[model samples]
Target: MTLGLDEEHRELGASLRAWAAGLDGPAAVRAAEGDPAETFEKVRAAAAGMGLAGLALPASAGGDDGSPLDVAVALEACAHALLPGPLLGPAVSELLLAGGHPGSDAVVGLAPGAPDLVWDAPSATHLLLPAPGEDDTWVLVEAAAVDVEPVVALDLSRRFGRVRAPWSGGVAVTGLTRARVRRTTVAMAAAEASGVARWCLETATSYAGVREQFGKPIGSFQAVKHLCAEMLETAEAVTAAAWDAAVALAADEEQAAFAADVAGAVALDGAVRVAQTCIQVLGGIGFTFEHDAHLYLRRATTLRALLGGGDVWAASLAARAASGVRRRVEVDLGGRDAGVRDEFRTRVAEVAALPEDARRAALVERGYLTPHWPAPYGLGADPVTQLVVDEELVRAGIGRPDLKIGGWAAPTVLEHGTDAQRERFVRPTLTGEIGWCQLFSEPGAGSDLASLRTRAVRDEAAGGWRLTGQKVWTSLAHEADWAICLARTDPDAPRHRGITYFLVDMGSPGIEIRPLRELTGDAMFNEVFLDDVLVPDDCVVGQPGDGWRLARTTLANERVAMASSRLGVSTERAVALAGDATPAEQVRVGHAVALATVCTLLGVRTTLRSLAGHGPGAESSVAKLLGVRSRQDASELVVELLGERVVLEADDPQVAADVHEMLMTRCLSIAGGTTQVLRTVAAERILGLPR
Candidate 1:
């Protein structure tokens, strides 16, 4: 999201990508496959010539002492070009030494577990691992003292071999902990994965732009467009995950472990998906050995497997989070936004300092309650201003009361209602003095919301209209003071053209509300019946037959309000619940953690786009699609983590809550729009697909 990415970093990445192109790209990668030694020397010499060997090493050690993020950017670029050589292990070794492990000039390699094959062992002067029969200590053995037997590897881009080292004569190293080593390795691997994913995205997109089918570029097809869009999303997610790891490691932040686990958990899987999809985009050529797509897929798969795959890391993420670990992604609002943000922060602080009971009124008086609205009612904030206000509010531990339906309703009214209507409703709605609910969806109409059967007959004789309709899934209807309604004003008109927008009083005659119990055993949703309810003409929001249009606006508002930078909330709780989780449950928990992190990354990318002057864009739609999946998946994991405890004792408090949350997630996919419906939206609307 460009949180701390500078021009220098951008140039560094570009330079590396270009440099890798000049070195050996995918063609070289394929040739070096199964036998890296033949082609390794040339790239090694080139890297050393560019001083890449000591990039992560301290300046005092004749190195650049580059930040972890800097190293990550470089790796991502290198991997994007499929640049070969034993890069990862040596860089990691340099980082370890900087952290006080003893090593110099010698290439260093690492082995993860007991009696493991160490990649790049042939080129290493030393190897590091936990010492045998030693407590909290590590051993560094000379390469000559180790037996290296070359073995075939899935990713032929790098070399690997079995290593049997003499630990008895090894140098004992202090302060190089297992936890630290694992964190660094996982983080760096994710960084490399990010590069692979980026290359897949770029290559596939570039191909789509040129490849033609049925008289047009393949990119013009909805299927291809959607594929590319998803690829873009995965690319961003991979980068975000890797960036989190690199940032945490370089800063030695509190979330170093948490961030690294999430990166390893999500990046590997995302990279694999992206690479495979890239092949699909390339069609027949992608399957042939002549194409480079398989090479990337191999490398991505190997890297994922090298670190015990996404499942292992995901489980680790859940275990860590369950232990009260949290990861937060912070953005640096550069230049003008930074100064503007500080100014708003102080004002927000002043309002926040008030007693809890009095805070709402203060916020309203300052026009911060609905900053996106026009002046007097609000500041009419632009995207940047809106985000600044949002950031400040979250920081001050202050929350603005959600105006419920009024959020969209009031905006709809202001945009279309007469001054008298505005004076009667907008102010109170913004201040929370009036509560609003929506009556748009009917049992027969959900995603096809325009097909609703509610009736609103005009009564010119009286100054109002008689309304009769049934609204399903009407949340807050039982508690609402007012409702923004949709009813068919003219059944003779077309399906979408006949609906009209109206505001109905909850206390009106013939209005009945029955609670609809859900799988959670909670009646948060209700079925509202309006039998001949009277609605004054003044209560109408817009011209008759405008319900569908206004309802769409309200629906959009709902989606935006529901969007968030959090998905791991439940997973974190589930982690705590599954402290002694079984291996299977641990893997499930890990999957949830990874999903949550990716959801967050997606949201960050969206906000970044908005802040960059792009209005919402494709992510707004894409997020809903993925977010529904994340929420539902995480909820299911919570229940699965509980295992038989949930089934045996359905009434247990914790068990019940987890079950309820899981059941509640069912609505996510069906609510604003079904997953199928959203995908089509992305394909046709965003991706330019045929209907």
Candidate 2:
């Protein structure tokens, strides 16, 4: 959940946190506010002694030559403690210098452009300024060479000043490019932003848990819980985005700029939003000067401002994405499975050599289709092996067949069904011979699925169960060969209990499927009516009262499936539609791209955890919530880009598709689980907010 994932980075973060705590940064800031001359000299010296100033610089520059990720972890910890004094400016300046510039030990200020406010100007020994009319060129000058007019800034933690410098007097730094400098700056700043967001979220949630109102803890209220949940989402988004930006910068990949732009767009603004929400959660006490909440808000706001505003970053991101820049997320297994990888590659190649029609069966036979499942049904592959198989399959251009509803159904059958049931269903479903649909959601029990009214009565003469129920929003019901049905077996039992998981044949007598037209005018979903449909006793999964537990397993499988899904279709379409977009439209597109990227990062973090043999983190649930919003927003943005053309239904097929997509995405929030209900779940389960 923090910027650092592994043990080394965690240790570094912990060390920094301990170090920052000793500084009592807020008190130092308070002192600086009283005496501008008290510039925290000891604090700066301590940071320098820790080698943080040149953390990302090369060893030739007297730095440790650490990766940008290392710097990010340190910055995040420092920012969480509200550490003041010139960290960002000095670090950025060192990176820009790259060991060649003459001021490695000097405190440096960054003036992004001409007549721009310089950060840390009062204490800066040198200034980094953009070269006049030189397009991406920058110059380094001593602070004495420029005139600085100190400004009263919103962020009390740091000082700012407008600098008047002769552009020709500074030494032109040719080693660093504007793109490199900007990306580094934004990435590092985003790390700090994430820290601010993390602090806000933790502070708010902790305060809400104990803060009382109306004879109860405010966190017990749904509204407050939801607010804290939302703050968690934003804070996680900020962390993921910033972490990704640092990763990209350290790797120096082709799409590094795009990644940094995403951080700039999402992390900076998200931090500001989280800080503001933290204050809201803290109530009246948060609004006062004595509270530390506004300080974080000021810091977040300042970072966003210094980075050329969120809109600018968003537009840049959109423009880059429109030009076909995508941040590729690949898992690095660190050669741990060299032999396994080679074996997978050979097997995948063999499968690829088979006729396209035979590939699915080949994959299923070889256990490549469901590597994470148990042996025979799958390879019982660990997370690393699963990822390796995925990579090899993609490398061989072999796309795995989507199991659709069978994905959920087959998993449950494998885990909880009898041997005969697995033999009859799992392989056929895997091979696409037997299509499956779910009959769980009823008219009144969608998100509250346990409240389903479908009833099942035992038929002693028939030696099976007679089911009668109406299931709505059943995807692929009309085309499915079978269904996994949930029906109440005991009306007097608790809502969740007394239900039985049944495997029902779609062609059973008295079963009817009526296609339901969606807003997109498609009948992909259906309403299934079961009138005394008979399901054999052998088709029951687990015991009569085990349906709820089995249903949870099925839902868990669905979440796993969702987690492995690619970056959404809507995000890609939005990028495609972003060409020639207006600035305002670009901003929206940029925001969408940032969100989509964060969703991917969340998945990456989850995978990394799995690779490390750790349990799943909160990223999985957060990813689902954020993914729905990302897809919905992107799809809507696509329609907005269509503008007046959206009214013309069939005139332009692409426009029609865009419109349909927007409508289709509306189901994302409603389906699986409603956003509101999921938010409450996240509040209780993840954030530990009272229901």
Candidate 3:
């Protein structure tokens, strides 16, 4: 959900987006790089006239008070457009204001002499340059104390200057502290890096979409899509880290420092990766002086050094995080020990050694498999342990042997099954017994699964129920021993309350299962027809109309399953890919580290929110959006790096295997809830935007 925006900040972002979409943009920025006087004048005018420089500064400092989130939105827009200027200047100003400085005419300072750098010195009516010194006291030099010399910049639109200022300008504003300023500077650098990184990803993606190679959009190539995907991932992670810093700043100073350190390290690494990957996407042209790619790289380099570099920040954070913090705290048992650590390795290897038939048997014998299954529930395994068992199996690369609805159905039966029903049905499920499939979805029912029309009627003489209806997407039904059916058993009741969950024997007369193949080339989904099938009264689960609530538990488990799975590739594989790239591409591998760092930041944010008792919210949507975009970015980059060999789709076997990912990348935004849907969700939930 878009968080409700303050009208002014919302307008500011909209204006920036509108403005950046126009003109030659990066070309203009590139052209101005050589002419500092012209570029500075243009950027300073845009920033000041747009009122972007002091957005978050308090009103006491001749500024309209705003917040960091506001500035983030504005900067995100600027980054989206690849605009050059002080997107972080406002954030810096906010820090200054918070520190009790009311330099009504204060201007922020940066490392004074990088010609190609577009450092923050917006045409402030009163420039404040903090001179380098041994003492904690800041010597703020006025505009006149500064002598600006122009330098040729890679991005002409953003010229850099050499500033020579006196040791002191004006008295320090009350409340400004050296410690606060230092921390704020580091955080602002991270924010700037985030802006540049995102721009690189979006810019590269735009180019890939229109730039044709091999008679198709370059994005069609798996290598290209993956490169773009990776870029998106890097950008996303950086954004999250930066935002986490902002949130921490909002909450507490110490947390702010920690967050900023993490953000600075991650964003620095991400910026370099994004710049290099974008250049790769642009091919040979990206390396030339004529292109704007180098300009961004230059900025990334300058920023990386400006904020103490990644190593320094990372080391600092490591030291701080280790000090008195719970380094080995106990975690929730469900997802623990699934990594390739010692215990994880042993269990997986043991499971992997078992043959198909023996694996299930071994699992039953060893008490590792369905640890939660009720005695009548089929197999008696603890739920938490069962979750860990599945996790271990997946970690070991052991495919879950096909178990139809029986996997889900037996649990319902055991939970609410009769003694006779459990004796007859649950035993076979534990032995190399029959499988079961869920017959829940229908031609009209999907996300709205309760609107099912499958009917089951009482048959007094047969002492059972007769079912007649069709169920679509019944995975693995053809070889199932039973079907977990949800039907409209009480039509007069509320839609949700009217349904009943039942276990139907697959061998019953008039039941049919037809397989349907999915994008993965697997016959895992099917359509099932139940015609006059008889299910005894003992097969019904729970009370007659409580199926909806019971079904919710199963659906919730599905989500939990998805959330706990290994969501990305191994670090070893990523390192190998990085090793294969050129020296420049090795710099791109830093992007992988940046991505992982950002993922951690996202986890932190999610944890914080969850602690506050809220759902993942817009942050989750942002994470998802960023994930798909990053995957596409990485895909594109790989293809570009792979070069001519990318043309043979699935032809070389190795590269060809990636063809599926290439195809899948196109649908990344559309799956797991489309990016558009998520964007709307973010707008409503996070931004609190109007419908």
TM-score of predicted model 3? 0.52
State the displacement of the C-alpha of residue 201, model 2, in Å, after optimal TM-score superposition: 0.7
Each model's lDDT comes to: 0.77, 0.85, 0.59
Shift in Å, residue 619, candidate 2: 1.7
**TM value for model 2:** 0.94
lDDT of 3 by residue, 411-474 (tens): 5656566777777776577664767778888888864676889988878899877888999877
Ranking by lDDT: 2, 1, 3
Clash pairs, model 1 backbone: 222-689, 314-590
TM-score to native of every candidate shown: 0.79, 0.94, 0.52
Write model 2 residue lDDT over 1-691, tens digit each, in one string: 7898887897899889888888988778878877755656767888888778768667776678878788889999999989888888877777667776554477888875334778888878888887767877788888888888887688898888885644457888876677787888898899999899989998998998898989999998989988988998999899998998888875655668888998998888899999999999999999998888999999999888878777889898888887777888666778887869788888899999999999999999998899888869788877778878887887899998899999899999998999999999999999999999999999999989789999999999999999998999999998999999999999999988998999999999999899999988899999999999999999999999789999888423222221332347877887777776787887898888888888888988888877766677888789899989998998888888878777766578888777888899899999999998999899889988776
Candidate 2: the clashing residue pairs are none
TM-score: model 1 vs. ground truth: 0.79
Question: If both were scored by lDDT, which would come out higher, candidate 1 or candidate 2?
Answer: 2
Candidate whose TM-score is highest: 2
Q: Where does candidate 3 stray beyond 4 Å?
A: 1-12, 85-91, 97-107, 111-134, 146-166, 173-178, 325-597, 600-691
Return the lDDT, model 1, position 303. Answer: 85
Q: Write the residue-wise lDDT of candidate 1 on 1-691 in tens digits.
A: 2222455776788888888888757777766764567677678778888778778877677778788887788788778888777788887777766744343355777775444678677677787766766666777887777777766678868877685544456877767777787788877888888889878877887788778888898876767877877876676667777877887885554578888888887888889999999999999999998888898999899888877777878778777766666666665556557668778989999988888999898888777777777767777776567767777787898888978778878888877889998889989997777898888889999788778898988888888999998999988998999998889999999888988889899999999999999877889899999998999998987888877777766312122121243455567766776777787787778777776776776666566555555556554566676677788888887777677988898888878877888898899988877776666566556545444
* lDDT for predicted candidate 3 compared with the true structure: 0.59
- Which residue ranges in model 2 land beyond 4 Å of their true spot? 49-51, 101-105, 113-116, 131-136, 164-171, 251-254, 554-567
